[model samples]
Target: MKENVFYGKGMGPIKRDFPDIYEAIVELNDAVYTGKVIDYKTQKFIALAIAASNSDDRAVKKQIQSAINEFNATKDEIMDVLRIVLLTSGMPPFVKAVKILYEVME
Candidate 1:
């Protein structure tokens, strides 16, 4: 219901211009973030991985910030997740993630 600064630039405008889509997105975020089986911290890592895999820099930074703010995620924890991204998604995404990782983790 409230504006999510976590969603990054342009999202507020999108919410105003396309409320239906935004609502659906919010619902999806709620569903995924509930962490029915995985637990919230683990889900945050997964979300971070997904963001990296997609090469969505905004989402990557958002997830990183959220995980750090909410879970107090450490640099090692973030690197661990990025390692998985590297192994599965290859080098480029992993490198990008590593760059953002340092930007946020410090």
Candidate 2:
């Protein structure tokens, strides 16, 4: 993963105003994303699928970007995840996430 590539809203304010809490959160994230057994790339794909299922456009885009930039994730891998989203979450979020994926790729 990259050094300073956290993808979340309001992190700047949280890091500045509440440094301890921010550090704790970062530490937790690090622990969770340690790539033990599952690997970080697959974890990112899971996160992407979850974001797509939730219809969170920004998070989906961010996940796609991070996967590509950090893990060199291919279109096929992302499409595979989106296929799961289509089955589990239905069309709306699946289509929305697919659109975001294309936009990010472009």
Each model's TM-score, in the order given? Answer: 0.82, 0.94
C-alpha RMSD in Å of predicted model 1 compared with the true structure: 2.8
Best by TM-score: 2
The candidate 2 region of ten consecutive residues with least summed lDDT is: 1-10
TM-score of 2: 0.94
Candidate 2 lDDT over 20-104, as tens digits, reads 9899988988888888899888888999999999999999999999889998888889999999999999999999999998999
- lDDT digits (tens) for residues 1-106 of candidate 1: 2123447677788799989988888887787678678887898899899999988888999888888888888888999999999999999999998999888766
Model 2 misplaced regions, further than 4 Å: 2-4
Q: In model 1, which range of ten residues has the least summed lDDT?
A: 1-10
In terms of lDDT, the best-performing candidate is 2
The lDDT for every candidate, in the order shown, is: 0.84, 0.90
- In the predicted model 2, the residue pairs found to clash are none
